[model samples]
Target: MDSWPHPQPLTNRLELVAVPRPVLTALVSGRAAAALPPPLVTPYLAGEECAGLWRMRSMQLSDKPGDAPWVTRFVVVPGVSGAVGAAGFHGAPDQVGMVEVGYRIAPEHRRNGYARQALEILLSVAGSSPDVRVVRASISPENHASRALIQQFAFAEVGEQWDDEDGLETLFEMVLRTQ
Candidate 1:
């Protein structure tokens, strides 16, 4: 896979650290951090559930190597060990210039506003890109926390969809105004 410069999205309390394709491969294999590519150190290790997400992201990186920079990233506090969670888009913007985002905070880190911070960073990136016209998020109806998060960003309820893995999801979208 071709490498891209790491883009670390920052906030007052967090940074979304890029996970290179090589390191993603190592993560899928359940390898230790030492097995990851040089000069990269991630404090987070994927749990079984997160590992499944990582596997999916690994395949995504394989299919669209250029989308690496927009894929999953570690959500960490500066100088902190272990990520508070993970966040990113489903992939690069689609043919119609829409991108879907997903984020998850570790159980222990819940309610600390990490997910909200990550979502802000993701939206900022989408808004700044000329290639992105719509930002979408599909949240499980039962996931009240995430449903509430999107509201803060002015995303409107557009529709619904059923996913093979996640079942029913309430789709929300925010259309970016062209400059």
Candidate 2:
């Protein structure tokens, strides 16, 4: 495969790379079916039931070459320990100049600042992209950790959006020009 663009380095602890199939398979297989989170499952199975989290990981990794203009997927690989903790993105590539980020950390890797580190790297990468002028994070209002993480990146509250699928999401905006 050709080298992916904007390969940003996370904290000295982790590295961000294009999400690959084998890594995704390992991530889903490492977790039990019951322990998997709902949001993580739905998109992967196309709203169908699955035996493990592999379906979700598969969906995350199976980014077609020409699916969307603004969307991208990446794997969070730990540098020191060489562990693959999670996968995430820079939102829909076709959404004009707007860049949104979404992500999920594995159950075993929670509370380790992995999410924050990975998000910062993604934000930096997105900000550097010529196609992206602004970056946004649509997080759940009640998700204190996610809210706090965005705050650390200086994402200002822009507005709120309610979707049939994601429900009420607090839209936070950060301008790359200011960074």
Candidate 3:
């Protein structure tokens, strides 16, 4: 089990656990039902909607063995046995010290502070990294909740882009640290 990165001041209610390599493998191989026992894997994690994302992460791990810590993580409550959502950096900081973040809260888990907590955790991690100077979030224009969440952190609307999978996205960026 690769050590999952937990760059702290951790949130009181949420914990981000690294999705183990075994779990990713099972998810990408479509053998989660057989490879992962119940309660160890969530249906959302193994579902079709997230299959491509998981596969992409798997490819990242295989291509860059040291990037495990920067990949997908399960957002769980400390005392809770299951995850409420997923969040993490798109990858390690780029040459210019920018790291993009992505997150999702399960439908049933939405409307709570989980997404906010997850963003806080991601920003904490980014701020702790010397190589990370800018934290970026590409939210769809229709994702009002995410747009609002980043606004609370003072992220500037730097630009926008077209994602083949997610449609048009508004790009937001915040300095990782005041420095």
The clash numbers for all candidates, in the given order, read 0, 5, 0
TM-score of each: 0.86, 0.63, 0.90
Which 10 consecutive positions of candidate 1 have the poorest summed lDDT?
Answer: 1-10
Off by over 4 Å in 3: 1-11, 177-179
* Winner on lDDT (1 vs 2): 1
Predicted structure with the largest lDDT when compared to the true one: 3
Sorted on TM-score, best first, the list reads 3, 1, 2
Q: Please give the lDDT score at residue 30 for candidate 3.
A: 97
Error of 1 at 144 (Å): 0.8
Q: Can you write out model 1's per-residue Cα lDDT over 67-138, one digit (the tens) per residue?
A: 888888877665656667788889999889999998988877789888888888888888889999999999
What TM-score quantifies how close candidate 3 is to the native fold? 0.90
Order by lDDT, highest first: 3, 1, 2
Candidate 2 residue lDDT tens string, 75-125: 344332323343345444445577677766655567887777677667767
Q: Give the local distance difference test score of model 3.
A: 0.82
Model 1 residue 120 CA deviation (Å) reads 0.6
